[model samples]
Target: MSADLVLDGLDKRFPGSPTPALRGFSLTVAAGTCTAVLGPSGSGKSTLLRVIAGLEEPDAGEVRIDGTDVAGVAAEHRGVGMVFQRSLLFPHLTILDNVAFSDRVSGMNRRAARSRAGEYLEMVQLQGFGDRRVGELSGGQEQRVAIARALAAEPAVLLLDEPFSALDPALRSDMHDLLDSVRQAVSPTIVLVTHDRDEAARASDRIALLEHGVLLHEGTVLDAYRRPQNVRASQIMGGRNAVPGVVRDGSHHSALGAVPVPLDTPTGSGTLVIRQEDVAVLDGGVGPADTGSIAGVVESVRVTGARSEIAVRCGDALLHAEAPPTQRCQLGDRIRLMLPTTAVHIVAD
Candidate 1:
């Protein structure tokens, strides 16, 4: 059965570090759901995972699995499987032997453990490669073998700490697909720690954001983008344009001009954040200019995949706008930019 993982009011600090690695950190990963603890380096992302895995002790609070406190539990008895960035597979073992190592150590006989490991290897699509040595496997294959090994243990919870950060972009994507498929088979409660937002979005059912040892936001990925908890959350999750403004009579007055806002918005100084994709640049087409439209001069354009990120200078505020790749835009081109009122999410400065 899958276990629900919970951490409540967790705090941790190193001997000489000025800031605590985790401060009043609290979260709950629902049974069988993948929750990515997303944050940048030194943000306590790995520390949080370590505490839950029983590798590190917390200064305060408790770590619980299925309502039982596990603060004093040994790492091996926590019923958790961990896949680090590297494979860390034993050099002397075959792929099958490596996968079956944990099971055998836990008292399963060699035959039974290998049988179980073989099932998981096939699940990762490495059916016939079981006899191959770890040195002969590709990086992606090694990571897949590592994942297969973790799942083979049949742990109640699985912890993946930047497991694909070393893989190339293409291979990383393949691993992501493999993980997505593998989860449906065993369905372990997973906590995926990643610095990449795309990885977090693609791999998990929900997201828990941490920054400077603080638990800033927790919610579904869509809601996080639609309505960020604060200015930093808005900026971090794709809202790159944060414009300084003040609330006046249910509207934000800024360099771009008055933009309508909710009546209950704090009536004072604030910042309005908008996604670059939401900013529509008019070419005497798309959204034509009127008093409601704001105009800016195109400063630069860079194509990224199917869209072009165009920088527009509107007075003192320079904003980024994403346009279709086919749209013709030139530097120094004066264009009108249309920002729908709904696209503007007000956040504290």
Candidate 2:
């Protein structure tokens, strides 16, 4: 029921766009693995999904499902299930019928299709609302029905195009949990297209990062978080602190001071990437200074929700650190900043 999906040298150029939407983009997703294609608005995230779903033919390159080239194949015959950002359920159909539409179209008997639809409705936790009209259910409920409809067909590949982008924050979180549960029950190879990092990270096993129509990086969630391949990929995953530096011996010498980093890094000028969460802040009253300690003055403090973020000034550069909202540091206060060696990444430019 699940199949491996492969895209090889995919290139799609529209009539008047300045650049191709996808240029030599290639990725191999293992059977039943859920992967998210993450990028900005014009990065072709949805186009990549459309190509895989057979909605658009690639100008050059191929899409293969389970080792069979599906190029030029019809969307219906490709055995791919898709759920768009909008639910798009049939207006005239009842909630039960909307969930069962795929099965009926696939030629299952009326009774059998409704039976299976009821099972899927239960899977999406809408067991009792099957007979309600589509207009009667809420937006979240309709989206759930859309997902249930997609799963009822048992397609080899499932493509979700920002399925939760239209929902409120709380509803989006709930939909994410529901999607995970559905994937567990139906185990289809899934490609989730989303620009939201938290949504992508929550819904996917692996992440394929795209930018400007190119494949930037592809790896497990942990691998991406710990070691992104380049400066662009690192920034996409929230690696915001990039201080100019030079590679010296086997370390990087920056305004923040010299620190050991990857030596096989790019030559000449480069950047030292670090995340806010990785930067450590220590109160001067806590401990005596060591060799690696750096002194800085808190430039600003912002407390939002349960977390507080502060900017620290060291030399001519500024670094950010996050802490509990109860943290007592104020503007102009002196503090110590330490970046764990493991958290530092060198990217030559």
Candidate 3:
């Protein structure tokens, strides 16, 4: 069965390093849910996962599983399974034996272990590939076998460390679907470490963004994307439009003029953040003096596949917006943009 995982004030530092790998980092993941740990390289993403799996002991803090502290538990005794970016399957062993290695090591008979392995293979949609050697399968299939092997151990929690980062986009998507099916079948508590924002959004119920060994934001995927708490969080989540402004009398005053803000917003210097898709591009006929509208000249237009990225210059601020590919706009064309008050978020500078 699945279990709740909690990291309380975890701190880890390497010798001779100026900064700690993780400092006072804490998060609680509910049972049977997936939480993606997202960060750039050297942001301590792997260190966090290692601490959770009992591979690296924390310098301070508690690692709890189902309300019980496991501070001194050995890696093999921690009831955690991990899959890495590389498959690391034994080349000499058959696919079935690789998956059944853990069970066989635990003293189960070979027949029984292979039988159990077959079941997990079917779960990952590799039912008939058991007889094939590890060298014969494709890269994606090798990763599938790796997953089945980890699952066959039946650990309470599973930790994945960017397992699909090496695969092509199409193959990566297939693995995501396979993970969904596996979750439905066994419901293991999962913590996925990834640097890709879109992967985290697609695979996990919640996202925990980390930077410089510190927790930046932790919430649902939508919350991290739409309701970031600060400028750093906004930038990490791919926010492009950040207009310098000051909050006064329930309005934010900037180059775009005074836009209404939430009544509870404190009056102070802040930055106005809005997602690209939220900025609506309209014809120049729309009056610039309208309540939530501003006039700008198109500075750049880049069509990428199905959507287009538009850059508009209004006064001193350049705002990036997204529009349908069919919505043609040329450089220097005058346009009106509607910045709905609800979509405009004010964040601390």
Which number leads on TM-score? 3
Writing each residue's lDDT as its tens digit, candidate 1 over 234-310 gives 76676778888898887898987888876667888888888888887876732556655787888999998999999
Q: What is the lDDT of candidate 3?
A: 0.92
TM-score of each: 0.94, 0.94, 0.96
User: For residue 277, what is the lDDT in candidate 3?
Assistant: 86
lDDT of 2 at 207: 95
Name the runs in model 1 displaced over 4 angstroms: 262-268, 285-288
User: Each model's C-alpha lDDT?
Assistant: 0.88, 0.87, 0.92
Better of 1 and 2 by lDDT: 1
After superposition on all CA atoms, how large is the RMSD of candidate 1?
2.0
Candidate with better TM-score, 2 vs 3: 3
Clashes of each: 0, 0, 0
TM-score of 1: 0.94
Best by lDDT: 3
Q: Which stretches of candidate 3 lie over 4 Å from their true place?
A: 262-266, 284-288
Which lDDT value does model 2 have at 11? 98
